[model samples]
Target: MATPNYGYEKRQKELAKKKKKEDKAREKAARKLNPSSPGLAQGDPETDVASLEHDAPTVPELPTKDG
Candidate 1:
């Protein structure tokens, strides 16, 4: 008959928790350094979308856009 090693399991869980916290801290620091990074962008910026203008079309004015 073998006994369960609860202590080892508990230690492993603690280590995982510590690792997660450290990773979050590192990510926060990276974001602070470059907040505009698209891959890690979170929430919207302070700029107002209403202030933006569409003076130009991205794709050439389609010849048959009216249709």
Candidate 2:
């Protein structure tokens, strides 16, 4: 009878799949618990700049001379 050297390989793949499923479930539960989380939402910096267009000045960068 031949011994199975690839048994651990199969066990590792099964463990990886289980871990991924668990992580996804945890994320789903957290989002359900907190729908208005700041990290999950995107911020619009452009809107803020647009509101302050007259007060905000555009500065042009001067070319640097290499000695």
Candidate 3:
């Protein structure tokens, strides 16, 4: 059986991490340029939660039907 090449695996992991960082930086720059874009807004958790709370449908805590 061939021996595992730890160095190759480590390099792959590092490359993947660097790529992820670069992609995130690019996305952040895009967001800054287009802060009002809907596509980017959905990616943000803060706005998601805030919008959810602000726009949540009414819930009846108690029954209001006629007796």
Q: How much is the lDDT of residue 37 in candidate 3?
A: 73
Q: Put down candidate 2 lDDT per residue, 32-59, tens digits, no spaces.
A: 5774565554234443333455566779
Better of 1 and 2 by TM-score: 1
lDDT per residue as tens, model 1, 1-67: 8999999999999999999999999998886677567754344333322223423436766678678
Cα error of candidate 1 at position 17, Å: 0.5
Best of the two (1, 3) by lDDT: 3
Model 3 lDDT tens row, 1-67: 9999999999999999999999999998887677677764664766554566677687778866874
Candidate 2's clash total is 0
Best lDDT among the predictions, by candidate number: 3
Residue pairs with colliding backbones in model 3 are none
TM-scores of all models?
0.55, 0.48, 0.55
Clashing pairs in 1: none
If ranked by TM-score, best first, what sequence of candidates would result? 3, 1, 2
* Model 2 poorest 10 in a row by lDDT: 41-50
Tell me the deviation in Å of residue 6 in model 2: 1.5
